[model samples]
Target: MSVPTRQASPAAPPPASVLPAVPVEPSPDPEAHLGLRFPEGFGWGAATSAYQIEGAAREDGRGPSVWDTFAYTPGRVANGDTGDTAADHYRRYAEDLDLIRDLGLRSYRFSISWPRVQPDGRGAINQRGLDFYRRLVDGLLERGISPMATLFHWDTPQALQDDAGWANRDTAYRFADYATAVFEALGESVPVWLTINEPKTVVQNGYITGHHAPGIRDEPTAYLVGHHLALAHGLGVQALRATGSASRIGGALNLHPCYAADDSPATSDAVRLYDGYENRFYLDPMFKGHYPEDVLADQGPGSPLVRGIRDGDLEIIKQPIDILAVQYYTPIYVTTDGGTVQKWPTTQAAWQQVYPPGMYDILTRVTRDYAPPSITVTENGLPCADEVGVDGSVDDAGRISFLRDHLAEAHRAIADGAPLESYHVWSLMDNFEWEVGYDQRWGLIYVDYPTQRRILKRSAAWYRRVISDNSL
Candidate 1:
């Protein structure tokens, strides 16, 4: 697609000077970390997204999503694997909920496919599509689990993507309408509603690097899409509030704590710029009511993101949110020349760096800066190259260590005054991982793709005990 004509936009007032407000709280005595404990009423759960697991793509009046398009493309996904029969969850959710209950989960976080409810992303409602979620939610409630639903998880309806997707401001309004429709249907049965999941991924991976669905490598369009996504988030929150339901709403952001690769003054600028691109770009708009001036300036004049800003757009993009859902997998260490270095051990997923301390820093930083009413560590898990042992048991020791260390950091964060209310592993069972396909497994339960068998890994068993004891 040729670069679209830049829309002429008027001047919007610049935000105040930007600076990092990260302050790490001093930890308790080192001995206190030996045995970790959580407060009463803390939530324990697992999470999954619709496209990654729900595989009835053409059934029950469900429409196509960008994932369907991207995976079917010649070379987008690894091993040519698609989500066509992902863990067979659409047909196996009853057993899946039983697994959640067996694991002693009190809450479950899942996403709603936009095209599933309204096939074209707007217009008519698909009752059968909504019915599946109704059954899923009811099943969770029946199994003594609270449901948390995310409206969009990187699966834009193909129709929406065909219509310029998030690059067009109209898509934001459509999202609000879609959100209001879901709110009316689901009501407040879902205690927490996440408007968008990792908009940064859409901006960075989907648009900038073309590594994700609806892939496009146009830098000019990425941040414009980012702006529209944030707009959708605010609009969705407003729509939920207007529903008169008691549901808590927020945005699910993947924040990577940035640090200087070396103790050099030159690297400080790179770190700030990296932080601006990776974190503050989204954080400032939600909490401070303005786009990060550094990011806007980096886009420069006449860029789509800079040229497309309209008066009152920022107003719609900044509003009160009840929860701030965080998905932390790694941290970015910036070098002097705007490059990155991996200072910590990596994971099966090459992008992830196993630095548990980043979790504590991030939680405390968000609490100290944004001060969200409540925080939830929605997605944190290690993707292991898992295999079943000869004894027919899956053992993921790395995952167990990953979870234990990360949970210790989370406990430290809470002890230091982050209003963290819940923690959910990235997944309950292995399924089709986007782009990487089934190559990387990030689930507590091992999934046999051929037989649709579910076997709880050692990590799941370990997590069950932690949840039961409220300590580790």
Candidate 2:
């Protein structure tokens, strides 16, 4: 597949009605005199996944992933969009690295394509596929940006899925092997490694919701997949350690703090249920070395999912991690009017609500409850319908404020002893948003799909200043 080059389009004029507001004066520098500061060796970065950004799904001996099959099927994605040629990051990584450098980022977090590296998800290695990441890591190093690599980001090889997918225990072993291959190849350069990105999303959206890849709406199967993914994380860490690599390994969980709609008992119960499904299901096994008993009890007598826990699985899954990557978006509000609970004020994605305090609450809860590993706000950002005005200026004040408010809460969390190390926004550019396709714009920069032109949105410029000042 040929990658498209970004071109300059005719400049549009600024909207007269939305003039720039007067800039606020800077607050006194917080780090000036205080002994408190981000850890001397903290990381600052931006993250992207293989399937989310990389477009060369078919080139260089890369085999199909479950995502490839699901996306290509009719009615699977908005506008029938497939990741055939996403951001073209596979071919234009150098340019992308330049963008990272321009933002003065200290690190860049990206994922490896399993099918790309091990074409069939097992056996022979694809040297060509490895070379692409070699180039990407070297490029980041050349620009002084540390490369943080994730082994699995929900793009399981179609060959593996063809056999039994995550439902089969063998898939977990294959993932560990794949992890070892990646660690051996790039571990020296990529100091930070994440085992997986949001296993909950992988199981819930991909399996139960039938809204993502490997679309299967089997609740029992989805719960089982969740267990296997946790197992994979534990085994993957062991594999990376066996390589004798100096990389720091961890897992990324997407957590959204749940809030009750009212003080009623039913509403509070709804909150617990939602939290069990969203947060504790992943964290309890990881941090406490056991599944939340409440969650298991709530599953009730009718639930068909069986726990795949082996004698030593908890110890392996709870292996000490260097950091906890928390990808937070918005929180959900749960209300129980009668016998049923309802979600209110959800996003266009219909999965979340706009709640900034959730960030602070989540950070505090993780610190209070877990072993207090260094925490990084791995992914946090909003999706706005950013518009380029007639004057060629994009005014995304809403997104800008959204970032500022969240960062402010994060800063407060750090001040209150959360060991909060770094914050990486969810994305750097506007690209395909999974099942929603290109409908949602979450990028700091806007991409004109037809011409592949890149336009820095107002939020991007605002973020650049945040990076420069090292504060919000």
Candidate 3:
């Protein structure tokens, strides 16, 4: 993509000065010291979303999701790739669970497909769909792996999208109903429940950028969608509590900490707007019970983005959560011109910059700003174009280094009193990646797409050792 040239703005009244940068504690890497160790019983896990791994998109009475519609459209996904037959985990979850156990991971975090359970996004539940998850949970327990289930991972049922999707307040209510139905079925066995996963991505990629499912490029719709997602989160939490299950519930957010390219006031102002939209827009409501005022003003008072917010929505969105699941991959560095600064290195995903200090910055910032719940580093990993080696093994040294650096930062965050309990890598195995499809690989274990054979990468061996020693 080519960068657009910026034109000069007419001289006018200056906007308000930006807020001061929030202070955060920094912890040195523990790897520098030989005796360092993570807290005892610190949870170790690997995570995968349903659409990304669980294939069988049209099987077992599963209805279509927006992703299905999006991927099927030509030119939407790279190389015409889709998740129709991802890793075939739906037919091979038992073997996948065994792989997780073999990795010495104590926890396995996977998402339940909304369309799989409640095929239409509402109404009667599908027994076959629920049975799949029941078996998955039981299998995890059988292997001594705790189960963490995320309810929605941007797979909004197509039927719901036809009815205005998340822009409609009714969709939030539908989500609560769906959440309740799932909880009544599997909440007893699944110890942890993440109501929604990375809703920010849904609003930005799915709506604003038109890169993901139900692709629409409307800013007003994006805000409305984001608001409804937050409301759905609160209602989902309430539904879980109503089930009377002992499951802990929360929502996962992919937060990108923003920094100024320079110390100039203009750069700081750019960072302020970027941070407000990227981070605080979600954080403030979940933690502070209101949207960031600057972001609202940025959207303009007369914009439809501010019009959909009805009374009592924020109250519902402020529901207390037991934990805050965080998915951190990179940070944003904005210049005075409001364009991103390409000062850092990147991963296979070009947008993902290689910055370890971001882990510490995000963790401590959330700790100080939103003290409502414990923290979990739910998704963090590097994507590499991995291939099988001559010796029938995959050597992904880049991923191993990525994990070591990020895990070191995670350990430092814990030492700095971030209240982070668990850290789950982005994936257990490579499957489908949205938009870019299968081009990017972000798994400890590599899967041969043609054969569906799983091969443990060098990073997997290193991760297993870290899990075993509870240290880097």
Give one digit per residue, the lDDT tens place, for model 3 in 109-175: 8999999998899898888999999999999999999999999988899999999898778989999
Off by over 4 Å in 2: 1-42, 300-304, 337-347
Tens digits of per-residue lDDT for model 1, 1-472:
0001111111211211222322212133212325777999899989999999999999989999999999999899999999888988999999999999999998999999899999998899999888999999999999999999999998899999899999989999999999998999989889999999988888877887787888897778888999999999999999998989998999998888989879999989877877888888888999889887877887788889878888887887788899999988887777777766667766666667778999999999999999999999889887777899999998777777777788999999999999999999988888888888888788999999989999999889888988898887
Between the candidate structures 1 and 2, which one is better when assessed by TM-score?
1
Model 2 per-residue lDDT tens digits across residues 1-472: 0001101000111111222323322234322222223445556666777887889889999999998998889998889888888888888788888888998788788889999999899899999999999999999999999888888888899999999899888898999998888888886898888897888887777777677788887777677788889989999988987888777888988887777767889778766766777789899988889887776776554554445666887898887788898887766555553122223333344444556678899999999989557888778876677788999877777677666767778877887789887788778887778887877777787877776667888777777766766655
Between candidates 1 and 2, the one scoring higher on lDDT is 1
User: lDDT of all predictions, in order shown?
Assistant: 0.84, 0.75, 0.82
Tell me the spans in candidate 1 whose CA falls farther than 4 Å from its real position.
1-33
Error of 2 at 193 (Å): 0.5
Each model's number of backbone clashes?
A: 0, 7, 0
Q: What TM-score fits each model?
A: 0.93, 0.89, 0.93
Off by over 4 Å in 3: 1-35
